[model samples]
Target: MAEAMPQTLLHEALQKHRAGDLVGAAPLYQQVLKLSPRHPDALHLLGFLLHQAGQSAEGLKLVNAAVATAPLHTDFRGNQARILLHLGREAEADKAFRAALIATPANPDALRDLAITRRDSGQVVAAAKLHARLLCLTPADPATLLAHSGNLIDLGRHDAASALLRKCLLLAPALIEAANSFAFLQITIRDLDLARDWFRRTLAAQPLYAAPHSGLAEVCFFENDLEACLRHSERALELTPDDPQIHVRHGFRLLAAGHVREGWQEFEWRLKRADRIRREGLPPRWQGEPLAGKRILVCAEEGVGDELLYASMIPDLIAAGASVVIECAPRLLSVFRRSFPGCAVHAYKREGDRFRPVHRYDWLPKDPPVDYAIDAGSLPSILRPDVASYAHQRPYLTADAERVAQMRDRLAALPPGPKLGFCWRSKEVAPFRNLYYTGLSDWRSLLTDPAIQVVSMQYGRGWREEIAAAQKAFGARLHVLEGVDMTDDFEDILALGVAVDAIVCPSTTLVWVGAGLGRPVMEFGVEPHFELMGTGKHPGFPTVRVFTRSLAQSWEAVTGAITDAVRTL
Candidate 1:
């Protein structure tokens, strides 16, 4: 065998490799490679064998060489991508997987791995496409079916998701993955009882699983079972203490259930989340520290709604004599600057999940400079710890005085009836969030009432056609103000919300703007958010109230009730 020809040695190596004799295979692999340098098969297999032997770095180097030599070989590229993932080079791994799929589009392993990668990274749209292709290739795999169902759920194709989930469970009744997906599917469809049942079923199979407990907590919260909500939340944290999302969610659960002290403490865990925007070069987090003269950077997170919600505390910061630097969304820069006259507001651009500071104020100076950066969401934990800590929401955010006057004149021109501005839908109508919103169609009867004048405050791109359809169907036109790009004009939202007689809406930027303007805000949702602090009403904003439909009640009934409430106003 030592003097055997390269083909014979390679054949022997392959045979031993297939027989699980890596020790026997390694020498043959070496002989083949020694006889024939740059042999792709020998290099690939030897590298994989070393990787199996816990020598990943050397294995990756050899595999990289193989991929470089034969870039079009799907097998080589496939394993090379796996090694890239092992080294935690996810972006490179994803690109390599795409190249492998391009080479062999029907490659089951490539499809499965890449689809799983995309699914885990929150790229549901791309993952769903890959999952479809993979299911075509390997239709019977329970895991693929389970994963694809989740993507379907995220994409808001719940009926398709339900069908896939049912098929996945039918094929593998005791599969925990299928059980979990099935539970989430039920929750997405607003079947809380069924979701709770499936979650319990999943827990029966795997008692130590934290996710089912968290899911149960979510169901209990939506069902208004506050005790069970916090209990399951605690159990979830007990099972998986290190999961930041569970901690943050438990904070919401606790806060909503009236546990203020522990809630703020737990809510602070959001900063530890992997998905939180990176404020790498910014100042250290100001954890209730003394900031008499220090310049603090209070950066906004997620959206302008969040900024407006939390900016209610900036006055307190200024009162503490801190020189404040606020970073907000581009749309909010003007309003935030005007609202917080003392603070310098800079508009920053978001690059994926990282912050890219556009221009810095003098406070961003390097020498002994801004060493305290805090997320706007984090301020409540430090500043407003209890109920009385609120600054009493009497229009903390200010609109342009002239714009407000103009909006008032515009409203007066509509008719001699009560003007009710409303946002009927959230821009994100995904499964998890759709529970918080009743669609525009659900509010048709309410919006069509001729007594009150309806103004379309719904933002994002498609609201005009939707409002027009409402007008065409009922002949009661919802006044959409011209020149107000509701999506981009944050200041106009401030103006319009302020000038309106009342605001009736689901959660949106308009909620904060209206509530901040001290207007009557009749917020409708499946349940009151944790901001209500379990008190049925927002503590600071006296004019704001949450109207909700119980699990036993329908959305249409809730909308009808909201209509009656608005008519009285």
Candidate 2:
């Protein structure tokens, strides 16, 4: 076998590898390696083939040896970095990437590898900068554009990311990846109708791209069309059965729609997203008959509002004789700790000695170890909250006394009485979607009346632009809350709410908080959200005044109704 090798053997093997004929070139490459065990080219090429063949460890060893022997070889270093990345060896992969970059500064492949490694290592800003540099060298490169768009999204620059994707689509409308990004942004901005349009367009362009099917399934879920969600999710699973997110999505939709028994069983796929349940730090528990007297760790998922909404279920689980440990976000740590004073609570990501369990409830164990485990959403039904019983207790959140005093003093400086807090715009920024869900212009009508002082409780970008225009139109009526920096934190949000007479927001989580506070909340929007108002009255909060788009998504009519209501008040 060693004697059969010619100079062209390496070349022939390379050609076969390029043509995806790994089996055809295996014997020839073996012969070459047998004759010269130290050959860098043979080692590098075989390493790639071995990795492709699912022998990652051996492949990595061979690739590392090749790189050591040929330290300056760009191809060897790139291959080594990629194999490290495939195995999720972030630190080692970062070293290989830097080596490759030093060897080939202008190499687009190396730059891409470096960007991916940065992203994997949680250096997203650095990765975005590298991709931006790569895009300059290769402007039309789809991969570079995709990386940049994803980075932009992580930074919460959804509008910029969507713009880049739209440009990418215009350049190559058949680019399924770009279409997926476009569709995802639409969902984030609450443009489900437009998202459906994008998904249809992408599916038309590439019928085999199974990713968009998942998007379609989510859209169906949002619409409360469980039948369609199931159908689309099944279609997606047919195309990509191993996607855990798809399984979780399907399971959650099923659970939310009242098929709880099976939904919990199906929803266990969430553990597969990462190697372990890193957030909750609890072992996976299977679904079966609820075990009595078992120690359970009920893991919290999703946002802060979600944790609060679901914490009511703790008493029920306790009554079932299961001890509970609540794991949630750090900001919610103080709040949840206070709310669930009877039970133990901890921040989700902090690692420590594992909580010993009679039976763990985090994972979807096949035998269903513990007696009962449920998501936060299940708490509401388990403990049907009667508003009347909790009505007199008012103020679920406390305003920072100092911040409240500061705000009060500021408000006192302005023309006094009947202050209306306005949060017209939502954080979302897709022009059409934002306009549909947030009645920014609608609230502006009330701003011009001069009778009521408009306090700007609206946070996020683009508020300055709107305020600047409003100053030109309705000069003295607008009392913009100047120099008071607020965050997404509930403490800051509550402070603003406490300082106002009544809060007017466009169908946000703020509306929920206001209603919970027994404040007069004017909920305005151009279209319905979560079946809240088919015509009038919000299903979630009865106290909220519903002013929706009157005819064909008219913001004017909604705003007009709000002004008329305020005038009557």
Candidate 3:
């Protein structure tokens, strides 16, 4: 009867706890604990109630004591791990969860806790394995399926992740998270129509959900609907004011739409992204203030193409009485050094040991005290804030005269015809980016012109076969300069730009390089970049003309137009 009394009290406490009456449950649990001091159930239950009531310190002690009393008890250990995780004691929680798993290897609660803890601790592989184990235990759990799919995405197994998401949606069609994940994957793959459909479906499932609206905004931005992009982005911000990514996206949209001031303000959110480089021991960022004698470091932020594009503003910076230092990609060091003789040029040291270089500003000189540092991309916002400000448009980059003469001589030696440079592809192969390129076959119409001697300015490996195949297929002469390596030598490329009568290509770095060197370039693409936002004409280079493919038109039509233009040239 003595033990029976404690058991009866414990049963009542559990009933109240399950019924969401923590106030009624706590005292009954205390009564049971007083009768049976070392009872794990009573101790764990009371601790959980205390923790839920915002008394985590005392509750953690109680739960630890419960685990100590019943060391091998799976429930006790699992509860301890959960409480530890809740209190942000990740290391302790990880240990406790491992212990619980040792006690019962297939304990679902223990497995889930451990999996989440592993993922949070950056043990993604282990977390994914744990999640897989848990899914095997409960195959139809939508939450676990979603979590596993997220791990798959982190592992770059997107197709597998996509399959899992589809399965999750099938199991629970109303699952908004599954729908959102699927839609986001679609966006990553540049399946804009499918992405739009799924994002709308997610919105229908949960009207107030902010993420789908943000997704729609990105879709609209890529589709060249600036007003719609802004509308969706604003709505998303209204729904969730604190999302930094959405703010960054909104900034790009605004900048692309020619709302420079507002866009620049929003673009500041790029600093908040995890991938943004944080200069540990540098002075604060520059805020477009007058610098009479201050030394400013213009740090390169994004791609090599962006660095070259933004380098146009350096002479203006030098003219403004600030001594400028350019931190740029290693490949651009020579080009920038020669172009901007007044400023110091340093190659940004690649960050990691990975094969593909990830460039960051780790080479800033310490002795020369920098008054301020600014992102290169941010210069447009400060220096050229409106369409009128872009009037200082002249060829800022000059090719090496010797390289120019060399390339010019080589081109002159070719069979008597117009020397035309062409690049059909870009290095970036993301699904959305693929939309920017035309297949080599699509260039046949342009290549078939016997009056033109097509020079292969296409860079990267495996291009020789493409050029040969095109020549064979079209029965036309497309000449590739034998000695000049176009990929590594930016100076030679600039010289080639000078040598060629004109350049014909899709929007790529070659277009920027050609335009920067004052070569007449005809650029074709679907989306309008910020450089060509207000007018179809490039703001920085008058020699470059943009031809955008209409949404309804096929690549054939765009190429056909180019063919006509080439014939006229």
Residue 438 in model 3: lDDT: 75
* C-alpha lDDT of all candidate models, in order: 0.82, 0.68, 0.82
**Candidate 2 clash pair list:** 284-363, 285-363, 285-365, 286-365, 286-368, 287-368, 290-371, 291-371
| Model 2 / residue 206 / CA error / Å | 3.8
Tens-digit per-residue lDDT, 264-316, candidate 2: 44566765653233443245442423636675666665545555544545655
How does each model score on TM-score? 0.90, 0.72, 0.77
Candidate closer to the true structure by lDDT (higher is better), 2 or 3: 3
Error of 2 at 212 (Å): 5.2
User: Per-residue CA lDDT of candidate 3, range 21-129, in tens?
Assistant: 9999999999988888999889988998898888888998999888889899998888788888888888898999999999899899999989988877667788999
Order of quality (lDDT)? 3, 1, 2
User: What's the distance in Å from true for residue 444, model 1?
Assistant: 5.8
The collision pairs in model 1 are none
Best by TM-score: 1
